[model samples]
Target: MLILKKLSMAMYMDQEDINIKFEKMGKIRTALVGYGSVGEKMHAPLITVCPDLELVAVVERRQEKSKEKYPEVSIFRSLEALLEADAADLIVIVTPNEFHFSQAKMALEAGKHVVVDKPVTIHSREAKELKQIAEEKGLVLSVFQNRRWDGDIRTIQKILAEGLLGRVVHFESHFDRFRPGLADNWREQDVPGNGITYDLGTHLIDQAVMLFGRPDWVYAEIFKQRTGAVADDFFDITLMFGSIKARLTASVLSKAPMPKFLVLGEKGSYIKYGLDVQEKAFKAGELPEGANWGLEDAQAWGELHLEHTSMTYETERGDYRIFYKNIADAISQKHTLRVPIDQAITVLEIIEAAFLSHQEGKRIPFKK
Candidate 1:
């Protein structure tokens, strides 16, 4: 009788272990808010490809557009409906710049982990409050600074880490495009946090901050160059780090070709042209899997001009899908968040300072 009782207990323990393992491997139900370009093109597809995540629902205000591509995914009329129905374990906010803060706050308060698109929020204080809420609730909060995974950016990071740049004296990054006419969109309109600075500026600034920590002072000139442009269409911002200068600029009227990145160091210089291949692929409706997904062609490689010789340096593979994968791991496997809320707050602080610098026509001292 004693032997039989011990056997029963061992079997029960084994069953419990199996159950725990299965729970850990279960998929996180993800709901995407806003089915705009970012949602429909990037986030939705990436979420679907992540093995540990299931694209369960989406919040579409007007039309049921998501149904065409994601027929199985339920469509919520609004964020409130999705929250009330408890339709998702993770909520991804890909809405306009204005809605990021309020939507993220609502999701966190409703006990759902949140992933907000770039800029996190319009203000640093709002981002901090969201961070506090997530911490108090013991939930994961992240911003989709996807450009950090860009091939060119990653290559720059690798070069910096390998000490190829020696003591970097200057870093210049650009996101210029030739759009002489303004589009009838929220980003071009007179809306809060609506401008090229908030759109492209966020990515460049985030990349700079990731490569080098905070800057000492910021000087900027933000203006509108396009015809009938109410929002800012051009920005040339400089981040001063002691002797090192980082200049980030973007303009819609830039018709001439400009190097995407230019880094000058004591030893040599690295100049790269062309944006990451992942954005074009995503826009082309390509899935984020397969071996050749993020690979950059050798023809598009950057040039490393040294004192005597210049060579083409291959760019690192750009993998934006890793962002979603990291989110899944953070939620299910207890991995640390790659793009934490605090980092997003820091980016917003820099942005605020840049605007101040442009407004007051003086270099603003950096402050936490």
Candidate 2:
């Protein structure tokens, strides 16, 4: 009798401990809606690394690409199937720009919190509608403006905050690439929201807005530089904020080395070369966690040219993991969203204005 009583008590205590562990875990089951390069390289790894988030399922329409990397994760052949199964509490839409709106809408209607990639939707009105739906459902709706966490951008932010670059006069950001031949992909195709403006322009514009809120006017020039290209491969956009002028440009044919960021202020100037190291590391299959992760080399630091002197400024650490962690926190009501939907709407508005400016050959004043 004594032995039996001891065994029963042990079992009860073990079960209690298990319950505590489960409660403490408190991980939100996350579902990734696409299996493309950004999804595979950046989103999946970041989601897996977050302790508060679990990558539970994936939406791969044709192939089971996610299974090999995430064996335990269930793979659904379609978003509809995943929704029917109610597999996830959080849905991350990393599909093409065209599908972002419909996919995000479906996820929200299914009562799931959503995280859409940059340019939340191709149109500002659609983004506002998503925001309204999420608000009505009391759910979190966020856009992935991940470049706001870039090392070079963070360094620029710090410089501006500290007044190191007193009274910033001009800001130039470039996402130039050397791809003379067009790749066979949806981005290069002639589709709505298929261009450098929607692809790279979103990031550049978002970063600029983060730094200097909204601009007074937007003037842009967009073109198709590469032969046989149906979509725009080049863009030079200028955002006028009173006296401060921000030039955001990207090109597919530029072979010359241009600074990734060049900011001119009354006191000094900052010029940074090379993209964030984290992106290259991510493409190389490196996870987000490590002692040396997200650190830019000393040689790659931006140079601050001041009156009678110039010195290299240490680049800030870039961590995209913060974006996912914030998402998890926002879902749990522990924190407010870092990348809000309204900001994304403003970005789309600016993108629209840029297109209008390009077509009309005139600068367009911001309405709001």
Candidate 3:
């Protein structure tokens, strides 16, 4: 047993060689799972652009699709085969929400670091189990809460840091869209983790939790607004913390322009509209190289209103690639995980609470 422990420690130390000497370090070989829209457009490009990471392999069930863009990468039909081949040091699971738990468990048990797309798992308990496995194996585990680096959120962080928003009191965030009809997508299907509450709600909830810790309680009203919709299309969740309240809402029927973020504080308010530019660039298949990759146009800037005057506050450049860089650093033992599994689990807990709140028609106290 001691011999096996020694071998595991030695292997870990060898992989995290930067901890001993930066000159001997090598790029972390990363494997991507599910070459779907997000995997192809966002994860692959971000991984390729990071200096400390390499896109080495991908798991695709059907045709060799990833080869068109990443020809150098090895393609496997199943994650079991990839693990058998010992192809990569890191596994990125960008598969659908239901597959996240099983795939992440397999990778972690195989002693590979993992990054799961947001919401982590279908249930918070499943996420807790994955966290235990990763901790027992001394592996790096994180969720892809990439929106934490969105331009507007980054700008809000800066504003708070500079005391420009003086003790924020209310934060209202909206993620409305015009898709009144359901697309034939898995997210809108009758699945274990389907609905806007788990889709956009994950991002919105994570952002609120990241900014204001856990809420004291959750009160939500969730519904399937569109006809013939199996999954929920609308939600208005409110998280209360002492004198502050964070309201997060989303719907598929909203057509008119709505405020992306409306923040009120003791001093004044900050109102912002328009989504971050990185997702648009990524969906358009733009490579994440060069300095200007995430810069928001001045026209999309938000407004900060004080008692006497209101001014345009420049939106900070949003960089999704930073998430990959942080992952690399965390693997090298140079930095702590930015979106730790614990945060993701907390997001899941809040989600569960919100659902319960809706079902019971009462404000539910958030479980720690």
Candidate 4:
């Protein structure tokens, strides 16, 4: 597959073989619902990599910024305007958490394929509503659970898949930083779905679900770890999956951040540090198809332990753009979307349940 050339999974690539796979899929027309950090820094750059996808219009209130950054692209001041313009076949919602449900609902209702950023929606009810609406519309409704594209985590997943870690017993995933000072950003403001729990915690929790499916119960402590923080900043979410337990954590007070992922199984363990380079690459204006896109830096390789042997394993470079590419392919070629709305709803359920658990000071039962 063309993905093989760009993404290596225990195989060496020969150019002729790669091109044959690339010819099978066609390109798609895409629209951006928000022109914020995610739209400009991450999504825009990655869109360039997929030969089958075009970045048609960007929805934003600030026309000047949109015009300045994407001069050749159509700029709409609102979702209403964008939909009226009928600029593209797909709408990607990178808007704030509170707007996700309504915006995604409108896009799907309008017969446009939709992809919302993480957290899916403020609540599971909203997610379920969107899922039903999208199903009725026969449109692809997906969430951008982008961290699964992280190189370290993907490598960890590969290890687990290969039985290198045997049967995983304990897994820890963290997204922490020392952002003691709050930003004027909407994420720090008092808003539903605007907190570390929905922001960083969603990625970790969604990943846990992706690897292990939904848990039977969840125990979480969601609180504001930073002084004067309006929203939650610290959370220790525990997922109980019968025989195994997974801990997904995030903190604003962490000065020295810990490993990105730590997985322990019956046979061995895997420890990884540092976030993937794809985000940095996207921010630095590298295309998703850039040379050596997800290739890991030697210095940032992870460590693996098996039996009495300890070895350093270079993390597979994560390509967040893959999520968009897959979504585009799914839209055009009838391939199954990577992060479906149902999966997104499950993520929201976990998040809401975690919050309820924290509020009630008890474990929350998982509800299908």
Residue-level lDDT of model 4, residues 1-368, one tens digit each, is: 88876677425555455444435534567888888888888877767566678787888786657667667888788999988877888888888988988898888888998888888889899989988988887678888888888888888778988898888899999887888898899989998778888889888988888888989999999898677888888999999887788999988888895988899999998998887887777777666775698888798898998899999997876878778778876765446888887777788888888989999999999945
Superposed by TM-score, candidate 1 places the C-alpha of residue 75 at a distance from the truth, in angstroms, of 0.7
**TM-score of every prediction relative to native:** 0.93, 0.93, 0.95, 0.90
Error in Å for residue 81 of model 4:
1.3
Which of the two candidates, 1 or 4, achieves a greater TM-score against the reference?
1
Off by over 4 Å in 3: 1-18, 21-25
Measured with C-alpha atoms, the lDDT of residue 3 in candidate 3 is 100
Query: What ranking of all candidate models by TM-score puts the best one first?
Result: 3, 1, 2, 4
Candidate 3: tens digits of C-alpha lDDT, residues 1-368: 99999999776676446476533548888999999999999999999989999999999999899999989999999999999999999999999899999999999999999999999899999999999999999899999999999999998888878878788899999999999767998999999899999999999999998888989999999999999999999999999977789999998899999999999988889999999999899988899888798898898899999988899999999988889999999988889999999999999999999999999999999846
Candidate 1 residue pairs in clash (backbone atoms < 3 Å): none
Candidate 3, TM-score vs. the true structure? Answer: 0.95
Weakest 10 consecutive residues of candidate 1 by summed lDDT: 13-22
Candidate with better TM-score, 1 vs 3? 3
Q: Model 2 segments beyond 4 Å from truth? A: 1-25
**TM-score of model 2 vs. true structure:** 0.93
- Give the whole-model CA lDDT for all candidates, comma-separated: 0.92, 0.92, 0.93, 0.83
Q: What overall lDDT, based on C-alpha atoms, would model 2 receive against the true structure? A: 0.92
Which structure is stronger by TM-score: 2 or 3?
A: 3
Question: What residue runs in model 1 are displaced by over 4 Å at the alpha carbon?
Answer: 1-25
